[model samples]
Target: MKTFIASSPHVARVNRVDSIMLQVLLALVPGILAMIWFFGWGLLINILLAATFAVAAECTVILARGRSPLPAIADLSAVVTAVLFAISVPPILPWWMTLLGMLFAIVLVKQLYGGMGYNPFNPAMAAYVFLLVSYPVAMTNWLTPTMLAEHHLSFTESLRIILDGSLPQGLSWDAVTSATPLDEMRGKLDRDLTMDEIRQSPLWGAFGGRGWEWIAGWFLLGGLYLLWKRIITWHIPASLLSSLLVCATLFWAIEPQTHPFPAFHLFSGAAILGAFFIATDPVTACTTTRGQIIFGASIGALVYVIRTWGGYPDAIAFSVLLLNIAAPMIDHYTQPRVFGHGGKRG
Candidate 1:
């Protein structure tokens, strides 16, 4: 009779790669629904297009390299990458632009660098920055939550809008497109407007700004769900948010007229999502708890510094990517020592 043997930690667990991916997909539902409700079927179109292209790109690369594509596609990481890419993009982006981003993300950022675990940067953020630089106009066409076309988009119509720049008469993306709250606030600050004056604008809300608080809320809910599912931990998320708050509190205390409040920073573009989903990517983030805290805090600090002083209104992507590059070094210095290890010699 044959017998099976196993290593230590003999307790069994139910977690699998597929299950984790499924949980992540489920967690994104709230945010995806929010996007569709606000931005219309254009969000759906982008998601479908991105998912399709990402799988295709991955398969093509695998085939060309004489490797098995089925396993990779089955793991669902490609789907997650596509979803992240789609969500980060403008809803009304032309289909070719979306395709280009997927190609870059899947082929270059992901596969060419030795596929998922080997890539240095987050594929989604890399594509986002690429699109932003390559097509500023299309990438910046963010639809305002309250502004939708009179006629609701059918699936085909939504596809048409994404594939072609044309929309039905009087159904301009222009009507829906508006500046994000962070961008608006940054613009006002650039114009020498006081923080109080800027906060009094129509864009301002109770905690965050107009049309932004709801989306942020949705992402936050999803993030909490992920945490509950044990797909992620609270260390990184808490550290990231706390660091941002600390920075914001310090700045606001020094000069309230110049710096926006902590609430505004917390509820603005990509803050919640970046803190949870993006920065907590296991492959890219620090593994140990201590390293995670340091990783999250560093990203939060970078986000504050970049958002306030750097050119971009939202620095989540840049901050996360920068910290990802530092994760290895963080882990190296912060890993716990073995029980019998002696103290370091002078």
Candidate 2:
């Protein structure tokens, strides 16, 4: 064997797009499992339908462009987008809605913009926001955690609901679906209830609503895995979580009765997932070290501000998308110095 010594480290083949996407899917397993544990089979069904439609849409578009779809399909970007969008919506969302979102994600948001690396917006979040805007009722029809659910839906029942968008005669929508934790917090806080009063409901557990906090922990675990694997650097996630924690602590300290504890902010909604997976998207997020910090900080701050006073309960998609639109500007101002240069490009 020939000796191949070099000062620089060798780039591992595992960094290929398909391999990286596979690693991401593997990282999502624990969190996805936890979600299924709490919410039931609807999430799984949603994943399957979204993946199917995403692949189909992507393939159709590639063929329309006079290209073979297999190579692109093997990269698994469409599946990643599908999973992200699927998990963001209600598990009981109708099949047609899933198809629409996938088409918007794969064809419109992604391929139309010149596909994967060339796309400026995160396709998943864009499709999610689109569906949320166009169909708010279906988008927000979240099921309460099974521990606190009035009725535990069977897999067949969940499948039927997603496929047909109907419930059994005796089963009312109000009986099966419940407001998400963020929704609960917003609704109760808007009604002038103290944080303590809101915490007393069976809907709550340690730091957040029942089951949600633990799901955040699992996602955090997955994020750590990604960091350890070197698939992602720590700059974005570290800054994002730190900024969010600081904001949460400051506000909670000022008014404990009105604001939630820092832990609650960290553990509830999509904070953990967004910080690690969504906000750190390679294409849409900042590139330079300083730019990444600023990008993450902005997202974290926006999430808190919007969730507190803006129309949405959770603001990850909105915040990330807004920052995505501004990423080029951020990088322009925060570029690292060149070896012989004293300052960044003007």
Q: In terms of TM-score, which candidate is strongest?
A: 2
How badly does each model clash, as a count of residue pairs? 0, 0
Error of model 2, residue 102, in angstroms: 0.7
Q: Give the per-residue lDDT digits (tens) of candidate 1, residues 1-346.
A: 9999988879766777667888888998998898788677888888998999999999999999999999899889899989988998888789898899999989999898899788888888889988887887788787666542345665676677777766766777555567888888889899999988887767678788765677789999999999988999999999999999999999999999999888999987888988877888878899999999999999999999999999888888888888989999999999898876877766
lDDT agreement with native, every candidate: 0.86, 0.91
Cα RMSD, each candidate: 2.7, 3.2
TM-scores of the candidates are: 0.92, 0.95
Best by lDDT: 2
Candidate 1: Cα lDDT at 218: 92
